[model samples]
Target: MAISDFFCPQTTSIVAKRERRKEARPGELLNAALDLFVEKGFAATRVEEVAARAGVSKGTLFLYFPSKEELFKAVVRENISGRFKAWNDEFEAFEGNTCEMLCYCMNSWWERVGATKTSGITKLMMSEAKNFPELAAFYQHEVVLPGQSLIRRILQRGMDRGEFRPLDLDYAVYSVVAPMIFLMLSRHAVGACVPAHVELDPKKYIATQLSTILYGLRLSPGDMEPSQEIPQA
Candidate 1:
């Protein structure tokens, strides 16, 4: 019998099912690998363990990711890229005055950080980066630089519009963003050693910090009454 005539509908259906199973294999393996990497440090986590987590044989995991390093990089990239896109979208939607825009951006970023477990992962990566240059480079190139650049552009626009005081754009960007970064790093990465100096409310912290940078905390013109003249003693 010819090949077409010999193949029954049941045989064709079985082949189609096998093909779908094969196609789904890689994604399943990647997800399993990511979960393991996040739960266990990348250097300590073994490929065999990842395969076991995915319910695939060791050889099958290699077919999807050639090396453990590649798999770890993929996990970080996949986790953070969606977040960057969301931030960009929120920034683009900002239509308020410059002060309002600054406040909005800070609030949006804080909300995002609170929403994702990625912050914990980020803390892990930073602590481990000294040992893994490749992963560190990937994060710097893919995440940090792009975010800073976007912020710098916003600051530049605000400066041009006279909504913000004229200052070095890079310096301005750093001034606004550095505190938030430090707060996370100090609390999560380094571990706070000091006793509670202030309440740890993220919203209030962000508002107070941003206001200090954007508008000095010193009493505004209307808030202070003119001082009565006094002769020097």
Candidate 2:
């Protein structure tokens, strides 16, 4: 409820638009926070700097986010939560074969979460989890569990259809995610000074990992034959 909205009925529409813009400031601030958090680890990012990047006063930032951890949680929610919901929504209506669904889901996952700078958050969590247990727990409940559940559902679907062998769902989920997790860690833990020959490339790594995963999951001879190569990652 902005002051302008209370003052006049005649200009109510204009005031409503102004209020909406004011409401949008928090999201803009969160986006700024995300960029800074990615560039500098969470512990190093200052609230004043986030406020400056967001074009708002430090007071305004506090009005929206009471603490730095709260702001970080907001950034995490913005980057992962909404996308997860949308991913599940799209997945619910997906009509592909189980194997195709696996590839489709991974490709979507990589594009939506992996390709973006936001993906760095996963590595951040891994590094900070011991020191920031509550934050790690929040992420576990909010993002990781939901994501693993989605994979579990897909694996169950394959088993039900006899497209895949019975699998230990927990281990299978780790198998699916390990490569992407490794890549995220490698980007941070493996410094930029590494030789070109030793540097890891995500496209190839993801491709090889997926191919191997599908190979083991396939129940039929033709199922193992890839319809298409992973496009020369």
Candidate 3:
């Protein structure tokens, strides 16, 4: 056998290429796991299936994630954690009129998540939190709280500037996001459960909801705009 053919066989290049791709394998595995978990859920998704989808063997999968639960945790950490960090960082740097900012943020929120695959996470959490308490807790601490905090900061800023009414910050925060949360759940959970509770065009619904919310939250009209004088004797 020629030395070149003996030492550097065809399979050798493929093996070397795969070895060079080791750094990306974990991310690939996590992405595959996310898709499967989103589709079949955590309880139903198998490690072997995730491995197959990721183009890795089960043994290789275990080398990175010892168990399915650990893999799921990695999925959460990789996806939600990074997204939340970037979102919070952007929110922190935002500067504008509170009403405009509120609308902008709400619209951005819906586009980024409410109508996307990420919305399924709300369903997953609700369904699986009882069984996966540790993962649920981590998700709450890392994702939910940060999200709530961002909402609270926006609402608090509006209130602080006399743009919105002074309201209970805690519950107000939740109320502000309640519609989006409900949409997320309803879309993923009971999207086609026979008779619908309410059919809506999301854009119109958001406009109406935000209008109502803004009306309620804004400073009283008398305080906002000067009252016209009554000239009648």
Per-model root-mean-square deviation over C-alphas: 6.3, 7.5, 5.5
> Per-residue CA lDDT of candidate 3, range 1-233, in tens?
77787667777988988887898899899889888898998899999999999998999999999998888778877766668767767777888878888888788888987887767777788888999898899889878888888888889989888888777887988777888777677677665532376676678877888998898888876653335444699
Better of 1 and 2 by TM-score: 2
TM-score of each: 0.70, 0.81, 0.82
lDDT of 2 by residue, 1-233 (tens): 98867768858878999898789899999999988888887888899999999888999999999999999999988889767778888778989989889888887778778878888898888777898888989999888999999999999989898888767898999888887777766665566433445867677777788899988886775543345444575
What overall lDDT goes with each candidate model? 0.71, 0.84, 0.81
For model 3, the run of ten residues with the poorest summed lDDT: 221-230
Candidate 1 residue 87 C-alpha distance from true site, Å: 3.7
lDDT of 1: 0.71
